[model samples]
Each structure stands twice: as structure tokens, then as C-alpha cells.
Target: MKHKRSLLALPYVGWMALFVVAPIVMVVVYAFTTAGFEPTASNFTGMGTYVSIFARSFQLALIATVICLLIGYPISYVMAKEGPGFQRVATVLIMLPMWVNFLLRTYSWMAILENNGLLNQLFDAIGLFDLINGLFGTDLTYFRMIRTQGAVVLGMVYNYLPFMILPIYSVILKLDRSLLEAAQDLGANSAYVFRRVIFPLSLPGVLSGVTMVFVPSVSTFAISRLLGGGTHMMLGDLIEQQFLGGAYNPHLGSAIALVMMLIVIVCMWVMNRFGQGEEQAVVL
Candidate 1:
């Protein structure tokens, strides 16, 4: 009775069961099936599809995840250091964009990154635009960062920043300040205190942030679509393409999706390990 009660404890678990787990099972079954409703393969013919995913889509996701983590860490730290009032204000400011539609925000980025955009106007005002025009001559648009890897990264950071910041900030806010004080009183310098005390204390936040940003950013398709000129297809975009009939190979697509999921799960495990490692470093 106790075990049964524990199993059914989560109401939201039903949603997870229906949506997340069910879809995953569907993909798994579909991955080994060929088109035209054939029952030839049985979860064993997706090796080629899985291989392509590793070679292309996985690389794209890894780059995007790295970009998010690199840019989000410092911003999260600053927000965490602020007082409660300020933290709330910053949170509101940071989260304000999330209240708006994601597609709208992506469109906004396109507006600024397109040719004859606001950024080019600012650059021209500063004479840098003309300087680039003189330097590159026929490649002003490319120089200005439109439809490139940089643009894709920019879009990812914009959408996922709040995800990274919120988790890290929550952990940092609850961190004990006494540890830093103790380190300082023991004649440790500022750098030492930060390296030995503050950073270790904030590891939980850091790990949470890394996991939060890394997983979704890796699998995200929209940023690459709008900013990457369709050439920088991430795993999300590839999976999405299959579902939306662009690829027309849903079987192959499911294999790609499952492989991407495995990568994310491994990353999540690694992130949790880092958090535990950080905890071990703390004196208490």
C-alpha cells in the first residue's frame, strides 16, 4: 500500500507520463521503422541515422550549450550578490522578456541583425560601419554579425539566460556568507577567498545553471533557424524537421532525437556529479 501510494504521489506525474514518456516511447518504436508503415526493422536499423546525429546535430548542440554557459555565469553572479529588493528588481528585469512570446523575441533579433539594421546604424554613427565597409567592401552584412554562428549563439543566450540565472541566483541567495568571512579572517586574499570559499559555496548554483542552459540550448532549433541561415541545423532543428515533414524521415528523426536525449542525460549526470564534488570541498 505504501509503495503504491508513493508511486502515485505526484499529480503532475500523469502529465509527464502521457507527454514526455509516451512521446519518447513513440520515438523509440518509430526509430527502427521504415517509411510507408513497414515493420521490417525492430529498433536496430537506425545506426546510420544515429551516426549522422552525432556528427552534425550533436556538434551544433555542444557549441550552443558552451556558448550559453560561458555568457550566463557572470550575469548570474551579479544578480545573486544584490540585496533582496535589488534581486527582485533584477529578476523582474531579467524575466521580463520571457513573458513575451519566444517567436516575437526571435523576430526582434532578426530586425536588429538584418541588413540596414539598427546595429549597422549605430556602427555607422561611430564610423566603425564605414571602416568595415572600407575594409571588407562587399561584406558589410556578414561583418555586422547576421546569419552566422555568433548570431545563433546570441539568440540562444537571450532566450536561455533567465533559465541559467534563476537557478544560480537561487543557490547563491541561500549560500552562507560566513564561510567567506571565515576565509578572509584566516588571512586569505580576495582572490583566495573567492577561489577557495565563494566559488565552492556557489557550486550548487553553478551546476544547476550549467544543466539548465546546456540541455535546452543544445536541442534548440529556432535560434539556428532564424539566425543561422538554415545551414547551422542543430539536433532540435533536425528532429523538428522530421516531425514537420521537412525531412519526411520520421523514423530516422526519432533515432536522432533519442541520441540527443542520451547526451542530455549524460550531461545532467555530470553536472550533478560536479555539484556533489563541490559540496565535498566545503569544510562543514
Candidate 2:
């Protein structure tokens, strides 16, 4: 049985070695080497020029993650407390957009946010812009919703919100009801029970949702490109430029990618430690 199990693992092991390990090894090698394949640290040292880009990426990602949490947690909690029929419908509605292609979804948002797009058209039809202009004594044609940092954040929130929701919903749904009842029996009110019992227990889910939302939001290129209109270039776009764009520096791109991965790892480690502390406190 042991030998059979070892054989069963061979395919997965090979797959990881080929896909995951190999790519990571290549990235590490490229990150630490020059274009001439000579070992060098300047690839990382030369990233000072892009400090603003890094800051913007993390800032936008954090904002999007916070927004997702604020919106998703309440929805998840409600779904968890609701009936099976409600949960089913809500789950489908949440997941329905995911069935479409990611690019297509983003493109749809681009259309909606453009100067003369559907949203602006609707605003114009309803005289919203006229009202604003009339009140402010200014001439206004259309709102510049697209090609801004706000647009980029909005895209990140829309694309990744479901990731935040599903993990929290699953975790909240699986929470032990007896514990909630015990809290209530101990004279805890709804708010007190949630703060003391529910929220503490949901830390794992919150952390997971945060990770899921933050990682992609920080690394996103297309959304920033399309929605931000080249004004808000993120880390992903910077990396892409090094490897594939006019810059053509794979070594630098790899260095940026490696640093980003390390930063994300450190952030997650810190969050996990915080979550563990919360869980321990709850246990006590």
C-alpha cells in the first residue's frame, strides 16, 4: 500500500517540479544575474526609481482589500444566517460574473467608465452633469471616471470581491452554532456575541480573503493599464515593461517579481501571526 501511494504521488511531484519549482528557480536565477548571465545585485539596487510605483500598488491593493472586506463580511454573515434557498440564490449571483472571461468583464467596465460610456450617457440623459454644472457655475460635459487611480481601485474591487466573499462565507457557514448559543446563554447580546465570538472565529477566513484579494490587486497590470490609462502604472506593468515592453530587461523584471513575492510572503506571515494571536486569545 505504501509503494502504491508513492507511485500515485509521482505525477503530482513531477508536475510541481516542472511547473512550480522550475519557474521559481528560473526567476530566482534571473533575479540575481545580469543580462550576460553574470551574478549581480544591481538588478534589485536599481529599483529606487520605481518607489512611487510600489507605494501606489500596495496602497490601491490595501484600499481594494478593505473595501471588499467591508462589503463582503456583512454579506457573508447574512448569508450564513439566512435560509438554504437564500444562500443558494446569493451564491449563484455572486459567482455568476466569474463565469465570464476576466478580460471581458474588465472590458465591460472600461466601456461603462469611459467619458462617453454608458454611465456618462445615463448621467447626461438624467441631467446629472447639467445639475452639477448649474450649481457650480461651470461647464461640464462628462465625468472622467476612466483612466484614474480610483478607476483602477474600482476594477480591483469588482474583479476580486468574490474571492473575499466566498472564503468568508464558507468559514462563517461552517462556524459551530453551539458556540454562538453558548455566548447568548451567557447573556451576550447580538453585537457582543459577534465581537467576542463570531469575529474572532472568522479571523482565518478574513485573513484568507485578504490574501486572495491583496495578492492579485497588487500584481494586476491590465486593470491599471485600461482603467488608469497609463497614468497609474503598477508593479505588474513595470515588470512587464522590463521583460516584454520597450525596456526588455528580464533580469530586472525577475528581480522585481522576486521582491514582490518576498514582500507578499512577509505580509502574509505577519497577518497569520496576528490571526493566531487572536485565535489563542479567543481560546483563553
Candidate 3:
């Protein structure tokens, strides 16, 4: 039985080590090495790349994460506590947008945010046109949504909301009914119970959701390119630039990839440590 079990596990272990561990280890090492695969002890280059990614890449991600949290929390809470039928409907509604091409969804924001776009038309109709137009009128501007930070957040939220919802819903679904009942019986109101009990127990799901949204939002290129336009750029776009743009530098791209991994790791650690609630981490 033991031998057979080991045999069964062999392929799984091998594949993980090969694809997951190997690639990460290689990237981490290469991020520290000199370019052109000619291994060197040039730690200076790696540190410099790391510093650059920290300052720029993380700033965009921070903005996107804040946007998702401000928007997703109430929505997730509603779905999690609502009737089953309503939850199902909300699940579909939230996921439906994700079914479309990510690039298309991002580009669609352009039409909404562009100069002379739907937003401007609506603003003009509502008598706020002069205020908006006077603020920073420019024929070539794309500020309503496109070529702006808001557009990028919109795209990231649209694409990654499911990530936030699914995990949170999973945990909230399995929340201990008795504890909530006990809290209510013990003279606790809804808000107090939630603030003290329910939200506390749901830390794991919150962590997972935050991680899912923040990690991808930080690295996504399509949203930035399509919505934020050429003016606003994320690390993923920077990585693409290193390889595909005029400044084709694979080594730099790889270095950026390594930095991304580290950022994700650090974020996960922070969530696990500081962001977690006092109560035990709940599971779905």
C-alpha cells in the first residue's frame, strides 16, 4: 500500500517540482544574476531592478487594491448573507463580466471614459459640461475613464471580482450558525456581532480574496494598456515592454517577474500576520 501510494504521488510531486518550484527558483536566481544567461555575481543589478519595481509596480497595485476593497466588500457581504436564489443570481452577475474577453472589457471602458465619450455626453446633458470642460479641456485628452487610473481600477475590479467573492462566499457559507445565534442571545446586535464575531472568523477568506485581487491587479497589463492607455503603465506592461517593445530586454523582464513574485509573497505574509482577524481563520 505504501509503495503504491508513493507511486501515485510520484507524478504529482515531480510535476510540481518541475513546473512550480523549478521555475520560481530559476527566476529568483536569474533575477540576481547578470544578463544573457551567463551567470555572474552581479548582485547590484538585481537590487537596482528590485528597487525600481518596488517604487513603481507596487504603487499601481496599491491603487487597484484599494479600489477593489472599497467596491467589493459591500457586494460580497450582500451576496453572502442574502437568500440562496439571490446569491445565485449575484454569482452569475458577478461572473458574467469575466466571461468576456478581458481585453475587450478593458477597452470598453475607453468608450465610456474617453473625451467626447458617453460620460462626457451625460455630463454635458446634466449641465456639468462646462465645469468638466473647464477643468482641463484638451482635444487629445482621454480622462473620463480611458487613459486614467480610474479606468485601470475598473478593469481590474471587473476581471478579478470573482476572485474576491468566491473565496469569501465559501467561508461565509460555512460560518458557524450557532455562534451567531449565541452572540445574538447574549445581548449582541447585528452590527456588534458582525464586527466582533462574523468578520473575525472570516479572516482566511478575506485574506484569500485580498490576495487574489491584489496580486493579479498589480501585474495585469491588458487593463492598463486598454483603459489607462500609454500614459499609465503597470509592471506587467513594463515586463512586456522589456521583451516586446523597442527596449527588448528579457533579462530585465525576468528580473521584474522575480520582483513580482517577491511582492506577492510579502503581501501574503502581511495578510497572514497583520491583516488577519483575532479569531481563528475560517475555512469554506
Most accurate candidate by TM-score: 2
Candidate 1 lDDT over residue span 26-65, tens digit each = 8887876678657656434545644664555556555656
**Whose lDDT is greatest here?**
2
Give the runs in model 2 whose Cα sits over 4 Å from its true position: 281-284
In model 2, the number of clashes is: 0
Alpha-carbon local distance difference test for all models: 0.75, 0.95, 0.76
Candidate 1 Cα misplacement greater than 4 A, ranges: 1-13, 36-57, 132-144, 278-284
- For residues 115-228, could you state the per-residue lDDT of candidate 2 as single tens digits? 999999999999998999999998999999999999999999999999999999999999999999999999999999999999988888999999999999999999999899
lDDT score, residue 225, model 1? 89
lDDT for position 124 in model 3: 69
RMSD to the true structure for each prediction, in A, is: 3.4, 1.2, 3.8
Flag clash pairs in model 1: none
Task: Judge candidate 3 at residue 110 and give its lDDT.
Answer: 76
Task: Quote the positional error of residue 192 for candidate 1 in Å.
Answer: 1.5
- Model 3 residue 222 CA deviation (Å) reads 1.6
The CA-based lDDT of model 3 is what?
0.76
